[model samples]
Structure formats: structure tokens, C-alpha cells
Target: MNIFPKAQFLILLSEDLFSHPQETMNKVFQFLELAAYLSEEYLP
Candidate 1:
């Protein structure tokens, strides 16, 4: 199976994500266009 070009993705390290959840999630929400539905305390 070939998965490229057609599929978009982002790779983040566990350490980086855990160390900077808010920043990381912001990027994710923006990428998925769900920033409007994101809440500050949602992940907490």
C-alpha cells in the first residue's frame, strides 16, 4: 500500500508533545481546522 501525497500527516515526538502540550495541540487543531472548537481546559 502506498500512502503519500494523497495523505497529509505530522510527526511529533512524545517528549516534545508532553513537554509542550498546548503549543503542540494548537498546531494540530490548526492543521485539522478545529481550532474554533478547541477549549483551553479540554486537554487538562
Candidate 2:
């Protein structure tokens, strides 16, 4: 299975929602953090 590019996906999926600076950055960073943690959990 493949996950593709989450960052790009998130960006495209959230372009309009990210019009505000703080909220957009906050949400993106939060998703990044979660993605990192999930990656770590699946690491070999």
C-alpha cells in the first residue's frame, strides 16, 4: 500500500481553509506532527 504525498494533499485539500495565517499554520503543523509520529510508529 502507498500513502502518496500527504503534504501536497493537505495543501491542496486545505488551500482555501489556510487563507488565515495562524489557523492554517497551526493545522498544517499539527498534521505534520501527527504524520511524523505515525511514521515513527511504523519504522523498521
Cα-based TM-score, every candidate: 0.60, 0.37
By summed lDDT, the worst window of 10 consecutive residues in model 2 runs over: 35-44
The candidate that achieves the highest TM-score relative to the unseen native structure: 1
List, residue by residue over 1-44, the lDDT tens digit for candidate 1: 27676337777677766787777777877878775445566343
Q: Give the residue spans of candidate 1 off by over 4 A.
A: 36-44
**What lDDT would each prediction earn against the true structure?**
0.67, 0.48
Model 1 TM-score (2 dp): 0.60
- Between which residue pairs do clashes occur in model 2? none
Q: Per-residue CA lDDT of candidate 2, range 11-35, in tens?
A: 5245444355455555666866753
